[model samples]
Target: MKRYIKSTIGLCLLSLLFISHKSVNDNTVIKLNSDEFNVLMGHQGSLEGSIKYGPNKGNGFSEKDNDIVYGFTDVNDKITWTVEVPETADYLVAIQYTGKEFQGQTPDCTVEIISNGKVLSTALRGLTQYNESRKVAGTRQWFDEVIPLKKGINTITFHFSEISSKQIKAAKEELDNGIPPKSSASIAVKDIALVRPKVWNAMKVRAKELKPDLSWMRDGKYGLFIHWSLFTYPLYGDKQAFETFEWGVNTFDVDVFADLVAETGASWVTFTTCHGMQMFPAPIKTLEKVLPGRTTERDLIADLAEALNKRDIKLLLYYNMSPRGELAAKLGIEENPDKWFQYLNDFAREVSLRYGKSIAGWGYIDSSFSAYVMNMPWEKYYRSLKAGNPDAVVAISSHWWAQYSPFNDLQTSDSGGSLNNPLDKKLFEEGGRYEGLQEHSSFVLDGSWFPKEPFNGIIRRDSNSKGGPTFSEQEYLDYFHKMAKANVPVTVNMLITQDVTRDQPFVNPKSLEFMKKVKIALGK
Candidate 1:
């Protein structure tokens, strides 16, 4: 959201140098673009319309150089704010924006309030941006609306479009002829003020509520997790890991995967979405933008969701985060925690929005990426993960080894304990109720998550079977019995030894047989 809009016209600038004509009332404004507690849902910082100082527009650099927010072209591109108000009341949102419209693009926007599930939006009759070179000269009032805000925290989202493909095409042609790309779409927000709301019969919205019910997760004590990724297949000569990874994704058969999980009688399955090398099985635009070839052409995630849902099984995603690599650096995310959070949040938004309804949960695959766990914006990241599907639960298993966090729905431990393992210390010791976040833990069924290929034939030769897959028959059942008694959700990771055995990623026949019995033992 814009804090102030100053006229940059040469004549207006010289004559009004002393007199101030600030655009809007700053006191009643809510900082929509502020990095404090806002998330640019589906937008990237690299594509911002940085045309504030064009040829003959400005002579020198100033503190207010990049003072405008731009590019609301993509349908998903939107700015969201979690605002805190004193009480429930009617408020007027006064939007100020300058946009160039062509090829059917107009001064149009969709204002969404997820809190109340309402949309109060409008479109200007004429073109909002009349001045091409002068940005502030194009500043005009967007339609006003008295929106009713709830008390406490309210999430307001703005999805808008000011520039069209025609303008972008023209700008591209201009770029070839010694001109810059200035016909970029933008969001020039002004202010929000308190107002008396008239009786509003606002149209209902499809935004889901954040009240997630994980009764299925709690009841279905056993969850099957598989680390099936590009690593599943060996790399051949001159083959990049990603290229082979795409083959793995394309070769994956969702029906076979569903049958494998069904054989175990597991109600939920945690499949790796991004792992060791950060390869995604679906065409996530955000991932593609950061690094080409990291995403697959097939929508494997969606297919998996369909197959699992058909069998009454929940699809949970495992996000192995390491957002400090070359891929992330290209996304303007370096060592900075905020930068890391921004990229991750954008990624989560796209994934969540796409598969929110079909998917049930997300797990930050245990302290697996500890080296790059920059002080993440947990709250904002959580919010973005629920952007499309509010009812989906999350498990912050990794990162800080955080057992329980208010930001997520499940508290997890990758390091399983002994007979009395997978414990929620807060509930057991502090006598605290695990209200929103439930106690959850994961351990491998046998060997390790990845085969000894990366281990270079070096494996843990010890007899330590606490969390490893060396448990005796009794130990396995006993573990589940204890977990069921304590009412904690536990995930058992299975090692995929071969790909496309019987047209499916082959799991150990014994583990599948054992899990079927385990399900019967639990009497679920």
Candidate 2:
């Protein structure tokens, strides 16, 4: 099935028809990565694009294979790829992209498939902050939609619109007035994947992750963990909890953090959503109602998930309860534990729904004592978190019930990597208590997950004085690989510092370098 017609309904004012006069007949997968994309810049706006791969090439992933098509500023910009299916069926059309061009706004884009001169499917999607960036579309957005196709060469084009002539005029006026232009809509096309029903690991719920499965984590081996919250803020003589968290929330760059993590070759990340304080980086209505001003409007968690998922790394959030809470006491939270938890559970549901399978795992409430003492419904809470995507692997504090808890999928335990709980089998063994549970052990390399008293978010100290790791490089790798091969997951927590002035967070540079070495030793 072939058609001989050069036409354009217009993705921009002049659709960039990247025509490849070759019919893709293989059933494996048709991928239009950075190398092969032929961009024909239409005569419209300032649309400059080329193949960008590795080192600041813009598609956040650090790997060379994660190349992207940069410079699609015009709404009419369309890139087309030809695919030949086995027969008339549906294919998964996933695009890998970045939305920084939109500057945190939704890029309502168009995607249409033409088969034999007729439109098969055309969808106008109000995509979540996404840039069609991966085989699974990264953020579980509609960019990973299913398109019906006829058995033969089918033309698929991904397009973005906005930045009309009026907006361009406005931007010109702003520039004339010595003001920065704010109305520029652009997107980087990483790659377009046309996959068959074989299903991408992070796709399909995944029959949406429909049932509990830990295979992905077990195989993932080890994860890079970082904790940044109210406690990390430099206090006493520096920025306090709320103040530091707010700054980190606003200034933290997901692209930088994701790139660093990708450079480490770690397959997963366990990011801190809350530690001693519930300074979450997402907008949760329930958290606001429970503790006003506690939640952020930025949706940092979602942004992180999108970025990490783009690099094929899984995300597991650490939602903790403060060991000692004077402020919480004053707020009367202890007086109504059940009601308080109800709000927290709702927030978890919201996070799960927004990120979906992109967030493959979760590290729920830290202390077992608090979970039980507060009468927190573990089963109910578990269900609420999984409601958005049921297949998510959830961990509970290593309680005796964690072994048999119907709602819990993994028994989680944590330590300072130097406490009574050492980083060994005992870390996950729980004194022989976890007889029948998937073991999880997370510990800090800095001896402290968050920066200690005087040397907090606002201050920096010598690495030696910071109470760093007790384990040697070989010791860490030996234990990490041993249990990882046994399907027992490990998360190595590294402390982070907040650059309040710069609105940036710095994970330990030495530790990150070690991770790169670890990735090599592990044969990643």
Candidate 3:
């Protein structure tokens, strides 16, 4: 029968009993006795234990914790326990075998243990992989070890270093952050079995099995960013005028955009497949009737995807976590959170299934707005994309979870003064250093949001643009070069407008030329 239980104490304790009675061909005997199971301090709930074959197996073993705990593994396995002695002396310890279920190993854990809170001597302090997986119960059976203890009056430090699912995640995250993975925090203590040691072994091993080395991101530093929107049309006035929220009024020229990317010599190019208020390929009959904003008639996404693919440049699609479409309202899922997750999941799945290997990653916009979209169980969505394209990366905007949440493969920043200022620079630098080791596969830089000429109040327009030097090629080069010095990969916007003849508000012949030169200067 399928059983669901929480807590590692149950799993480890139960494994002790089942493994002992299985009568295996190997002569290895796992001894779990009570003399070691009486260290538990509980007030209310009853503790239950169980050990299953694995995530795939259905049948396993079970146990319970009342006043004492029980555990068993290969004879060579070692468990460490830390206790704070009031004074320090020898104390008589014995097992109270009164329960209906009892299974124990030879030579109880009372081998003349002495302690000074400084030194601990155990015949063996860690378990081997063969004994752990074949005899032990849990996810990461390969990485479990006994912990060293430093005793004190108020604190008894117990180590639980083991291979388990949770521990494996910690190791990966720590590796990404460039820190040593420790097992003390991942394990739980039951009665006598210093369950702290080897608790995380299961987690450590699992992480290694799923992910591959991420040394590729450490080198590629520059990529071209193509902001494909309805606003890529020809305009008058300032050549960069189309570089505003007004991109809706513009029509993108796909052929020109593709030619520009190829000419620019960018190793990778990212395009906005969907954005707020507009999409390419003319107004959809459904959106035209329902959505109130301007719509386009061109399938800009399809055009650019094919164009970029032909050039062998890596492609990444940008998706808004918070959609501007009627789909959010139609599902009546706004504010409900859980429903919104389902909607986003479906949308992302469809996007990945269609684009698949052609795309390298999805740029998540407005991801900082909510935790559900930013932090919660979004790994499933990431895995969905990976399933479609095994090598695809998942990039989120602006240090979304760098501080106190799960880290993404990519870090983003908006060069807009608010987030791109010196303060942001300091933050990213520190975060970059911290994450450089663990997430050696990640990148951090500007290009998190729409780079426009101060439209919709999101961007602050320059006060001196009226009298100062008009937007020039040199300024463009300077902009990109500044980003390169920060050790961050830069992705700037190239918006498509409605009119085919007008220059984009922020981009013109001069700026594109400058972008080319800047790429060369950076040797990208």
Candidate 4:
């Protein structure tokens, strides 16, 4: 049976209700109901909504009669309540609310907690109400924070900020364009309680324990990451101008590329499907409908997956979640964040289903840290990927190691620089459910991912001026050995060159030679 903790009324009222009850201590729980609290609406010339009360049956709330307070959509709305404290000390504040979503789309609600007019904490909460019919249920989640209280009556105020009109307009425009409407944010407050620190710690520990296992990632020691796009081509003028899709996609050769990957002796290769300025290669129908003539005619992902499978090399696809530069502006992502996010999810679903088991994993970049990208329903996207291919491992680029572990299969660090020290495996093990480390290392002798000039059809050993400086064989072996010792896998980035006339794409000859020497040094 689940344990339930009740609240304490007051010292004077306690004697009349329960004379035989024990004295309240630091670990005591104090719960406040919505109907009994003071409500302040329209703080700064904002419109006011309504207060709703219902049977608190869902989201772990067992209270009855007027337990929920909701319908405040203005950004300046506030809910204030007073609680009588027995002593001055630290307490854990846990708010229980019901979040509703539509078809797996949800909105964000940010609540700022103020005690005696001083701000204590601000939490951005997600409310998704996708029902059980979708094989995923949107239920209640708890947000807990540590707060200090003084003896006597302490007034705590909760400030609510709803989604802006601009965001809602964007979602409506996307709906008109035949895209499913993302979820909107609404909250039904069941109860607000203050508990001991031990209770809060227990809840955190339970969340960590429920994370998915990622042992397969740890077993794969070294992998190759290819970041090729329009930027791979030579730029004559400003060097910062965006290259056209026609020039970059027309020269890619999957067969020659797969053969070189087989010779590297690496277990896996991650291909950048879409970057900031270009979509490398895709045949998804959704993308074709949304943005015409932007993708490659050849389905490089499918051909590469098939070729790598024969050589026992796994294929991991990389997609940048937060895109910038000219390509993003052309797609009108800046005008409507929700519209672009809907398109992104649709594209992810299409590709994940089309490739299925042939694709071993996915690496999502630039979302975990960006506030705009975090506002979207990324959990639904992750779920969509898993729905298509359950065996595939998913990871996100997050500086906080375990921040995405609850939703993703692994975590990635794009903090790439000179390879010198070993990664702290212990740091990655702390907050996440996964059990591996992923670090990026670049091989351009100049320490850049792309070369300044194009290699003119010849495979030269000393093309440092054309491409970047290639890593020495010893440098590759030493870095691999260091990663292996710490059980951390490294995805080394290598530059690529293309022959437009012959329709050929190949790795830089110097880098390829370095990889072969490293393979021999590893005795593979």
Candidate 1 Cα misplacement greater than 4 A, ranges: 1-211, 234-243, 365-375, 398-405, 416-425, 428-436, 454-469, 501-505
The global C-alpha lDDT for each of the candidates, from Candidate 1 onward, is 0.53, 0.52, 0.37, 0.50
For model 2, how does the per-residue alpha-carbon lDDT over 341-374 read when each residue is reduced to its tens digit? 6665787787778788778767655644443423
Instruction: Evaluate residue 461 in candidate 4 and report its C-alpha lDDT on the 0 to 100 scale.
Output: 26
Q: Put the candidates in TM-score order, highest first.
A: 4, 1, 2, 3
lDDT of 1 by residue, 1-524 (tens): 41222223343332233222344343323333222212221111112233222322211112122223443434334444445555676665534333344312443344332225445555533332221233222222323555566665555555433344443444444334433232333333322222233311120011113447877877898788777754543321333235567666666678887887887889998887677566788899988887787887899889989999999998888886654356555654443446556777898899999997898868544432222122344556778888888888887652112222235567654442233354434432221223345677677776566554432212221224222346788988988988878777888887663233354325655667788888889886
Compare the candidates by TM-score and give the number of the best one: 4
Error of 4 at 365 (Å): 2.3
Q: What is the C-alpha RMSD of each candidate to the true structure, in Å?
A: 19.3, 23.8, 18.4, 16.9
Model 1 TM-score?
0.54
The estimated TM-scores of all candidates read 0.54, 0.53, 0.46, 0.57
Q: Write the per-residue lDDT of candidate 4 for residues 30-107, one digit (tens) a residue.
A: 332221211111110112233333323121111112234444444434455555566665665545444343323444
Candidate 2 has an lDDT of 0.52
